[model samples]
Target: MGEAIGQTIPLGVGVALSPLPVVAVVLMLGSRRGRSNGPAFLIGWLLGLVVVGSVALLVAGALGPTDEGEPAAWVSWVKLALGVLALLLAGRTWRDRPTGGHRPELPSWMRTVDGFTAGKALGLGAGLSGVNPKNLMLTLAAGAVIAQTGIPAGEQAVALGVFVLIGALGPGVPVVGYLALGERAERMLGELQTWMVRHNAAIMTVVVLVIGAKLIGDAVAGLAA
Candidate 1:
């Protein structure tokens, strides 16, 4: 269990620091219906991570992810593939980064956040956490790492729970602050949102690249062993 948790920390951190989700949650907290939408969005984000991580664990388990205390051959291959995918995504993100003096704009859908119902916020949270390419890959890699440890199912659950908790931190911090500090959090969250928006591409590129390199290293080590 410790080993599994160790392996997943980096991946979980990658998910937790995802900029768009943090920005979205900050937007929700500043919205007209913030009181309702903020918490709903947080719940949805957590559920999304849980769902994706659970599915990956199930699939890895089915595939017999470990053999004789090492990752199974196919498991290593899957990690290699995921690592390569992450690198490709990092390249794309880096290429798309705002250049020169051009300002980065939030997506069109985000403009409507001020009027979103709680359900819509919830769904958006889920989509960003579970369906976004970078986040999905990181969560899947964490799941595979947990499964590859060959821990008992219960231990695997614990490790995954830890991963989910860590992954929730990015959006969770703002929601918690809002609940505790009310309007006092507005200024801080707004500042955070602006910075995140400005550097979203750079942050994603670096995080994805680091995780990609780590996954590839792990894969290579597993293959060599």
Candidate 2:
């Protein structure tokens, strides 16, 4: 469990520290129906993550038994694949970066989010957490790591639950603050949103590159050991 957690921390952080989701949630908090939609969005977001992670874990478990002592070769291969995907995604993110000192445009749907029903908000949350390429891959990678760790099923579930909670924290903090501090958080969240919009690409570039290398390196080390 400890090993799994260590390996998954970055993936969790990557999912949690994503700026756009937080920005969108914060924007929702400013809407008239924020009270219902914000929490609903959060629940939906967490459910999406849990669903992906759980599926990966289940699949990994179903792959049959392996040598008890040595790590499975497929685990390393999976990590390598995930690493390559991350690098490719990093390149794409770098390319999509807004040139010059301009904010990246928010999606057209975001403009209308303020009026969204709870159902729409929930759908949006699911789309961002489950369907977004970056988050989906990270969650899968994290799940694969846990599943491959040779831990008991019960422990694996605990680790996965922890991963989901940590990954949700980044997007969850704003909602907590909004509920607690009310309007006071608006200005801070707004500033954060602006900075995130401006630097999101660059930030993701570093994150994906570093974590990608780590995954590849860890996989290679496990295979060699």
Best by lDDT: 1
TM-score to native of every candidate shown: 0.97, 0.95
lDDT of each: 0.90, 0.85
Q: Which stretches of model 1 miss by more than 4 angstroms?
A: 65-67
Summarize candidate 2's per-residue lDDT along 117-203 as a digit string, tens digits.
999888888889987888898898888888888889999999998889998997789888888888898899888888887888898
TM-score of 2: 0.95
Writing each residue's lDDT as its tens digit, candidate 1 over 1-225 gives 999999888888999989988998899888889999999999999999999999999998777754467678877787899999999999999998989978898889888899999999899889889999888988988888888778899999999999999999999999999999999999999999989999999999999999999989988988898
How many clashes show up in model 1? Answer: 0
Model 2 worst lDDT run, 10 consecutive residues: 63-72
What C-alpha lDDT does candidate 2 achieve relative to the native structure?
0.85
Show the lowest summed lDDT stretch of 10 residues, model 1. Answer: 62-71
List RMSD in Å for every model shown: 1.1, 1.3
- TM-score, model 1 to reference: 0.97
